[model samples]
Target chain A: MSTTSTTAPSRTSRTSRPRRRLARFGSTGFIAALPFLAPALVAYLVFVVAPALESVRLSFFEWSGFQGAPQVFVGLQNYVRIFTHDPVFWTALSNTVIWVILSLVIPVGLGLVMALALNRKIFGRNLFRSVFYIPGVLAPIAIANMWRWMYNPNYGIGVNLAQLFNLPWLADVQWLGDKNLALYSIFAAFVWQIAGTNMVLFLAGLQGVSPDHVEAAKLDGANRWQVFRNVVMPSLRPTTVVVVVLTIINSIKVFDLIVGMTGGGPAQQTQVLALWSFQQSFNNHEYGSGNAIATVLLVITLIIVVPYMVWTAKQEKNS
Target chain B: MTVTAIPTAAAPVANPSPKRKPRPLSRGRDWVRVGLWVALLFSVLIWAVPLIFMVFTSLKSEADIFGTPAFVPPWAPEWGNYVEALDRGHLLTAGGNSLIVAIIKVPVGLFISAAAAFALSRIRFKRQRLLMGVIALGAMVPIQVAIAPLFQVINGLNLLSTNLGLILPYIAFGLPYQTFILYGFFRQIPEEIDESARIDGAGNWRLFLTIILPLAKPALAALFILDFVATWNEYSIALALLQSQDSWTIPLALQGFQSQFTSSYGPLNAFTIMSVFPVLIVYLMFQRYFVEGAFAGAVKG
Candidate 1:
């Protein structure tokens, strides 16, 4: 490579001395970058990128995850089974959609309201901010476990509250054990864990809103609701975009909480796409179908995320 | 029409330019402030309830846990619950495993990512944007999609149930965001510093080690705390890879402990509290950096 570079410099010298120097600089820069890039590149390719691509390839084959097992190339049969015949796949997909909607609506709405409220120069402002954000930092496993016991029928806070108020009908609601209420029950816990993150993000965005504009709108005889809707909401669009996209991504990746709280139980009612994939691949050992579900999740995620990411990169470049 | 007419009649009285204060307006504002305070208090209680309950339950004896009203504070704060958890729940060993993973992975992962970020941001290469784009895209790819094949790869390499198994993937998965964040910081450093260092006959390696890293210390610290918390709390990869009880991280151990001691709420809460305490401390100590790091990628994206 050095020999080639030396010979090329001689050929390029006829063009211009500065041009030849610039070419040398570029080449040297590339060479210097190679060693620095190697470690992360190699690990990312082998562990992250390669495995992702391999999942796509594995989705086309049938394998049961046994030692000495042969992989059978089955074409699009796995996809066909998931889309056309499987009931659980449909259930998981629909539940994932519900999870996405719940995440998008409840958390984002609550966060926006809280951000608006906390945007005021209230007493204990920082204390309230920290208190709300504490749950966001705790492990989902720990949060799920804590909430799981909180939903316990016999001695849980939920039932106890119902009984304390003489609400006999609510006492035996069976938060996690009822198939009808299980998914929403887990979602309530999830919202408790995640709403704070959205709130903080919105709070940051709210802080960025120009006080001058808000005052100007109020001076123009705008009511409080009108001021918030016209001025504050528009200013928070970027944060809303971020919160919505992140919530969607997080909703799709919901696994640990479900594993901890319900184990996709109460008759597989709360099964999500990611958890179903785990069950299929690891528990059932049906690698082909599992990979197919994973592929579907990846495709769905990228369809929403890739364009946004590219746009963000372009915005960063322009800035 | 009367409503509009009344407001117009009162407009002059309410619209003082610079001299007089509006008593009704101040009274209304005070009410809103009081309402906001009430809402803020409610939000705090909602967020703190589970944590408060966890602490209270952890301190309760078994009889107290089963017998007392759920809202009542533990009559006797059983410090022995923590001892029982440590002795029987495997919390100590699992915590050590988590600490080891975080210790080994965070610094090493930060170095590799920072080096790559330096290359992408500081070094003038032709395909630097493309490389950065690839890494950015890689950040969005969920680990769930790669779990099956990654499991096979780790198992094939005979690294399953080992610290290396968790560390390798943790670093790999952590690199993209770390690189992106460090790239932002690295780009903020003036190129003239590098030029002067080069003029002093310092090589690229020496310049990075001596000048660039020290300058990037804040970013490094932020990523350190963020990555440490994330690695310590990681569950999916650890669950899929670590099979043995002895090799389990805190999350895995907690799951196993929960299942085994399904009815032992006191010890379970103790285990939960112990596992989350380190992260809580780090977060409280570095609150500003923690929030900044969390928002860096999202706001930038």
Candidate 2:
């Protein structure tokens, strides 16, 4: 066996030099990549991976933040309370779903339409693209603050239009104050800011479709609607999937717009899971419950995100 | 790679004729096209109207903001709001904080993400594929979800309220996405170069730095700019970590200002306008790169 192992290399290359070279190559790669690999591994493990696991551990504890020596482990009590006992938790989660659906449905729908329009060799296409995409490029703080005024109820256009048209906006029915309208209003601001991103993605997807197919469809007497439905939609599936995933993730994580516009208020109508998590951790100092909520979100995210990622990777492998 | 086929028809006609008579607007395509342009222009106007209102409100007096029916402010606009918002120190300090965070974050984030992406993409190992999948899934985890435990870790490390502390967490949260994008770009690079580099006695570090990094400049630039913008505008983590007024970044300061100026629309609007310009300038300056980068980092992958 030893003789055969030694002779295998000699049979192929007739020398020990290439074996040494291969060994050197392998070692060199390992050594060279260590610097790059170590920092990322350490930082991510220390800050991300460890904390995530620790959060799951902490979710079982009852503790106040920064004022205690240690926390008491309560074992599923935190999760139990969040699910059954807490009104705010359910409200926050429902609001998140509401925001996600509204924001995703509108922005993605409009984006696909816009992408179809802009994908053509239309005049002033750049101008139109820029106008739509500007909101995306601007800082979130800027978009949020600007929209706060735009929704200002009195001097703002929304309120002004309602009043001028003899419909009371801020006076009779508070858009930001009403529970039903507040979440929807927040969703509107979010859609306005992020629609451009989806549009850009869809535009990229639309451009990926060859013009010949489109022209051929036209020659076959396929109407614009038919061509779009049959030819355009199927080709754009991956992009749609990506857009959907990103929109869902973005919707789930939305915080700045809610904080800037509503502060989760008139009476917790617009409170989302993210803001709720933050409020629990920082405002209420209930670190355990907060961490519990965070852990739940992480698990939920995995349930959605993992399958999609694996599916994409599998698609890539197959392709 | 979908192939298209040409339809066979008559080779030539005695007199080539243009086909029309399907739709009324087909005869005057120019006018219909013009109408489409007008409709597009109107939709754009709808998008811009709110921005214009914000600008006008910023320039108007508090009283004028309500009283004036004038879409365009009458006479010389009141620019006092800009002065007042600045004097309040919210915009100035917060802008400075955001700038500091962004500047530090860009290089740090780029190096880490690039290195990690390089290893993940190029290194063939048993665990590489699994690690890549993990990080991609990590990208989808909400930052808010991580906030609680992160606060626990940060407070334990005594990093609360310090810029470094805030910056550390931001970098951590940003890595999964940044690395995911960069990994895709890195993988697209041909393997021949790395083989050739190894043959030339170039070490992996030397090869990565000299060959791969130079080739990955566009991807790196795109990642750097995105990290900058995201870190710049980030609020939730910053809000939670930064409790002190002085340590506050622009988004937090804007939140603080929002409460203070809840009654006065002028200064609030002015501050909002002012707050956006730094980010605007960055975006415009790298507008070409931003557009191309969006496609490269996003579309292909």
Candidate 3:
């Protein structure tokens, strides 16, 4: 937190002047770093990188994950099955895209608004921040329980509100159980959990918007909204970039929430790609198809994140 | 303790608001304060009320749950629901397994990541950027992609359904984030310290062990608390690797409870309320870092 007050901490390394000193011992820089780096390197490669590569390879073959199963080479069949035949595949794919889109808008938007409002030197704001953030940290089981109660067909908020408002149909509406409303309902839960994260990020970003700058702008006859638009938003680009990237990644990688809450149920209505892939492999025993779905998810993430990381890394380095 | 602490550092009296010379308060300012309070209260409704409702329902009997309104607290609160859920859910066994995994994984993972971060930031060497990129990429790749292959690898090693199976991959996945955070902290420490220590004939190992680590305590503490929560709550890999119910973590066991809880809402809320206490306590303890450490990951690009 102390270091964060100065500037973005990640930028500090590259921006620091690279000072190479003549080794007192010998030309043994890599040799010296080896001991420090080897264990992590070996573990990461064996467990993370190699597995990812293996997933790509697994996608092209027909292999049940069961031991002693025949591993037959099926070129493009898994991918083709997902692309052309599986109606659920399209639903899962679109659901993923929709999840990503909704996530980027709702939580991030709410977070920015909360940050702007609570950025003041107000009393009790910290407690309020904790309230918003607690759900995000709570176990998935707890969150699922709360949201399920809200959306319960029998005794949920929908039912109670319907009763109070004299709207009979709302009570019948299955919030988590319905096909049409389920994905968005789960996203509402996501907003409840995630908005706090974005708020915290933007609050940290707002710390960088020097009060002096705002004061100077005020003296020069800039109004509040103008000052915010002109001074605050521009300086918040770095935080925004991070916020957006994290949002998209979280949306794409969203699995546990869907699994815990709905299990992609009510006749497989809320199945996003991540959950769909898990179902295909583990539940359905279509290992090749499952791996294919996984590969699709991996590519989507990389295509989005890699260039952004490179671009942002460059931006942080230069700025 | 208020505005003066941080603002005073850079405030040079050019600012309009001055506590030094008291002036007449403006009418507009009082209205703004009222507006801020309204907004804050509105945010509480959006955020805390559902959580409050969760607590309310957890205390209710089965009759009270369906008979009473959603928001109303029951007249007679019972702790028996919690006892029942705890007994039926097998939460103690699951919690113990989670604790074993997290306690081992968090420290072991942090140490390995710290060593790697030290070299990446401190040691000037070829292939630094390549290694850094590889680790950075590891953080973003979903665990789903690795689950199939990882299950095979764990199976091949005959480590499946064991704590060792869970700990190994958890460490691997946890390394990137911890290393990246520590690198940022370690990089900010002046290299002149490294040069001077080297001049005194201290090896790189000694320098890391004694000097750099002590200075990077804040980052280490923050990451330790954060990593513990992640390790405890992790589910995907655990689902793929853990075959037996005996070895299940909190999340897995909770999922098992979920099927039974679907039929009965009372015990479900009770179980959820009980299960979340550990995460809540830990979060509250390190919450300042919990809120602010989010931005630390932002610049990791």
Candidate 4:
């Protein structure tokens, strides 16, 4: 190892191990952060950053996917094919959009209402919070299996419970069978698992609402709804951002639950980009087209994620 | 394995949550209070029904499943379902595989995350916020975008279908969230400790090991349990990486196990019930920290 820096002789004469001065290169000083940064930086670059970059590259190239088959660069052909020829792409894109839109509505709608309901100093608040949140801790596959069993056509709980309760109309409704209803049915199960998450976040936000502000509003001729609207809602904007961003991102990448539930079935009406990306590559061996869908998914995510990160960076600077 | 976005908004800065009590109702006005209670219970019942059905169904015989109504509990508890699940599903083996993956991934992941966090926090460097922003964005990026290429990379490394292959990517994916959490934590530790330690001739490594890490114990503990649960429940990377059934983690194995017992959901439900215990035990024991972890992990897609 040689100290190639021209000024190293002066620094080295001051101390045997002039660590900070000796390690300086390219207008930077401090060597301490390097050892600590190396493992994580190297691993992340190789495994995550490099592969993620490859996914974009793979989108532009076609390969036969055989033993040592050479990949041929085919610039926008994969994207053009997906846009022009693939109807499933439209269904998946629409389904994913619906999934993202409803995720902001149903589950989190239930979440907001529940959070407001539970924000009081009620008895059993902890119990109720745990009840709603426990489903989230279970694996998505487990949740899928649980919901699938309940949706069974003949002996499902929907049928049996309808029978026991003497409701004839509810017994024959196919939850996961019909094409139009399958995506929504999966969303229902998704709500069962996710509503609690939104609730907890809202609850955190609610707790942060200064009690003094609520009291001052109460003192000035405000009702409960008025105080909530004026005082509580404004303070909760940050938490709501976290909750909404979390929902959109999670909704977009949802694959395991869909995979376990329908496998994009019933004539492939329920395919989302995440599962489509996986199936196109692994199942159909169309690596090029799969990467194209994945890149679309990546761009969709970046649009949302980038702004949120910028906001957090701003927050960090201030904090 | 724990995933989340940058949580500057809800890092739980140890706030003292002061509850606001509702005005006490007098006499006939009690209907308002009563109505609130009714709404609460009704909503709870709706939420609890599916879980209640799972518990009830797990304890019934195959004959009783069709014989009885869906809501009823078993007249006599049937432990046989659990036995068949444990005995035949080779679930114990899958359980071991899951545990092994968690055991390896959690500590290794935590070390890198904490070290990276330490560098980002304590060590002076330019582009710290840029690096921090990159990590925060990485934490939020959907893992699906990295899937196909990650598979190719693993194949190239000759580690396809191995637990190491599964966990290496798992660790890489885990770093962003864990580092983000620990970075928030490490920033909160006072600077005086670092100042005095350096005067005592302590180097960065010694200061980190002896002083800073000890002060960050609570954060580390919270991260520890959260990371464990996340690793234990992770599905996607395992799906893309762990192809062989022999190396399948719990979630992957559950999907495989379900196909075998499609006719008899008895063993399948039993296995699902059994699988919940480890997660349930840890969750219940550390319920307080989990709320934080859950909030912290909310951004995980």
Candidate 5:
């Protein structure tokens, strides 16, 4: 085996050296990588990349998704209609913005508070951590369903508790049914479902904080809040960036909960970009218009996500 | 590497010095600790209420579900709700479908993504960074953006509503994050190992399979759990693609069951509990790896 191994390289070197040199443009390394990458690349291209590009292409055309139907090129008309003519589009966009802001603040804020509270050597820290994180692990559909039932006007906890407490005004309030309250109610559910994830992430970040720095700050007369603000927060910059970016992306892609809980109901009050895109394309059969909304959503998401991705890649490379 | 380093730095703070006597100020701190405990307990109870309600409602008969307070335990637990969910709600079949999808998709997707990640991390090629960036960006591409064209593509291939259809996209969409994580892992492995293997007349394929793959078992396991949970809980693609009842996953089936049994909270809650139980078990079993993998993917990617 040793002899064959020894001779194999010499023989190949002598005969194949020139060819290998010539194959630099398509080296053995690159060639070998093809089989490794082909399956994922082909699938990603066909299912992800091509479809993304097709969505962009379809945005400029009017088509009902009928097989063999001609796609009429309408040259920005879809965009124009979405921007100027559609009231629902504005509501969805504004709601999406609200979602983005709420997801940014509430989950991040609560997660930070929980992380801080749980950071020290506390009793049942592990139990609390696990319990808090359970919601995040469950399916969003399940969470939404649970909350939907909780928000049920007739048999819901909200109404029943309100009635038990003799708060008639609170008892009669429609949580998911009212246009003004549906989106915020769903946002609250979203926060409950996701805050655990943020907590866990922040805990991980907290673990990385230099305890010595915190101790030093304390020794220098820094109070609890000051120590946290001065020592812990700066060290958690990386985690904070990650949490914020992920929350934004998750907020923008909010669909499952809306679909499960509200279905963008009460005059499309809860309609976000994603749900609206789905409704327009699949439900309304306005393929072009739907694709346009999807394209807008894509652009908006890319605008935020791409830069962060680039930043992450660069950070990883540097480290 | 860095993950290990961070914990070591924090370890000393966890254990106070035994030589130091307890001070009077420590009594004050005890009250603060109590406050913290109270706050944590309150949060835990609040966090658990919805799930507790789910279990309570699932255990009750239809009459009790509406009759009793949401928090009250059932006098006689309706174990038949689970049976009804399985039989009437088609949850077992949907669960089987979910299992099949996850079982097939997770490992297959991991292998494919690991392979691609191996290429990106180990192989010297032009356009490597650009390709990596593109794949990373793919992680952020919302499924809504691709659903329209992807649906059309699946229809064109006549794969829509089939498990294969769902599996394909799950694998595809799962690739970016899996590849990103695996690539980070692969980069951490020393290059000398690959060099020695190459010197021993091992090619790239053998080197990857024999050396690098084994070395990456932790990462593989982490991604395995993460990807499995994701695939199992995936909603949008399954909803859009798997239109037929037989092809529905747990989430899709749960949604359908809820819609069908709008008034019956017992079976609906039972179905909900059943669907989330496996994922919860997996998360609990691998809590360390799950949390680490989750944060690592986001923070280190």
Candidate 6:
């Protein structure tokens, strides 16, 4: 080899070696990140991390909020009250499960169907998709408020529709009153509000599916149902999983919909975990019990999310 | 494999290529497909009914809304309902508050999240990975649970009943997700550019401002819109932080309007329509970017 070429490799190796090795250890590039990370670190510590730690600490102390310093440290008494004593806690838990299941099923299933339909060469594809997704883009408070008006019995659509058919809609039977029907009524509103965005997500996933594979399936004499089962459904499974997980998580955190629609009303029948925690901590002035509920909610959310995250991470590695 | 053996099947379509003859559609099969579409359309209408009802109620007079013939208003259409709603509710003031927050929040949040994401992407540090993990985990926790202590923390800082108070939490709540997104984008840009810049003696800030920021403009714009929409529409925090009427955001004020005027659906509906207009306009303007940003970090391999 020429001396010049030989010298080039030696210099190249020397210069690139540190950068490559640093990338491997992921440690070489530190200075560039400092300015950006500093502010975020401070804010996270103060606003997010501190509050989370305080919640754990506050769960043990019995207090009526800022009224006075916590009178006593009950130590697990607050937690025990939830599992053993509080019927409301159990109701909220059950309501949470119901809400999660409903949210997961309706939004994902409807979203899939909507995506498939909208994916066709429809004349007004953009218009239709945009209209369906309007609810999701509108702020949550606005959508919830709109739904609240629609559910109003007097001069509201529900009343007018019921009167058109001569049925007692909101007056005789409490849409918000009956314990059995109350949760479902609130759920109906949620499904409407979320189905749009979920549909958009599913559409993106469907579009990502390779058209060649779909064409191959069609050429193989697969019927509509057979094609859907063997090709489209499997192709869409990952998107479905994403949708389901997000839906379930959002359901657990549901507050605005219930607050706007019913305020967990007619009785405590409609109260989910988020609203329950807010009521206990803020409204009822029971800080310890409220924190206890929040802690359990946090744990439960982790229980669902942590495993799924680990599983997905492993799946990503294997794939 | 037998068709039945394949439990998960994709819908099959007949080939429409000119080289291949199109398969005949049996009458029965065609009828079944049409029937399904009809059923689906009706289901969609059922879903749309509540929204349609809201629009209709807003047009009717109070007497028409109350009278025996509830379907038919006693008089003609009422544009006055909107005027009355504007007068009754502090709709304009509440809207102004929402606009101010969204306007302020977008740039601040984009700066914070984008800056953090840029650092995490460009620089290598062990602490960076750990910090990223902490943020990911925090995203799973519900914000509602954090409200009580968050309020306490804000109050301790003496920001209560101020726009700064609400703005602080809004930015904090939005940071993680926005960071997650921008970081993903920043990392995608090849490191060759950075190395070339270093060779030319571009300092860190100059490289970022000149080379990196311009390239990352699309991602920043996307984050701005997403943060704006989230902040503008946010309620639970607004309700908690801003106790006074002057500080109430649009959503909070709208809720207050509903309770105050139990009999008047016109103004309430009118208020709903007005409040949603600005959001809809923004959405329409930057819609392509909004959809792209939303699904960007979400579809991680």
CA deviation > 4 Å runs, candidate 4? A1-30, A64-67, B1-30, B291-301
**Selected candidate, larger lDDT, 2 vs 5:** 5
For residues B123-145, write the lDDT of model 1, one tens digit per residue.
66787888898987777777899
Q: Write the per-residue lDDT of candidate 3 for residues A191-246, one digit (tens) a residue.
A: 99889878877877787788899999999999989999999999998889878987
Q: What C-alpha lDDT, on a 0 to 100 scale, does residue B173 get in candidate 1?
A: 95
TM-score of chain A of 3: 0.91
Clashes of 2: 0
Report the poorest 10 consecutive residues by lDDT, candidate 6 chain A: A21-30
lDDT of 2 by residue, B1-301 (tens): 0011001111123323435444764757667667777888888888777688888888888678777752756366888989998997477888888889899977997788888888877655456778878777768888777777787788889988989998787777788888888888787777667776778987767877899888877667666776777788888888778889999998888878888768778888788888878777887776544432254334245
Docking class for model 4 is: acceptable
lDDT of 4 by residue, B180-244 (tens): 87887787776656666776767778878898888877667667776787788888888888877
What residue runs in model 5 are displaced by over 4 Å at the alpha carbon?
A1-29, A313-319, B1-21, B291-299
* Rank by DockQ (best first): 3, 5, 4, 2, 6, 1
What DockQ does every candidate get? 0.38, 0.41, 0.53, 0.42, 0.50, 0.40
Worst 10 residues of 1 chain B by lDDT: B1-10
Off by over 4 Å in 6: A1-32, A163-172, A315-319, B1-40, B68-75, B287-301
Candidate 1 per-residue lDDT, tens place, A225-271, comes to: 99989998898888888788778878889998999999998889989
TM of each candidate vs. truth: 0.89, 0.89, 0.92, 0.89, 0.91, 0.87
Candidate 2: tens digits of C-alpha lDDT, residues A14-73: 333443553568833445556777877787887788878887888899887765657998
> Least lDDT summed over 10 consecutive residues: which range in candidate 2 chain B?
B1-10
lDDT values for all models: 0.84, 0.76, 0.81, 0.80, 0.84, 0.74
* Tens digit of per-residue lDDT, candidate 4, span A173-264: 88888898899889888999899878877876675688999999988989979998899899988888878888997899888789888999
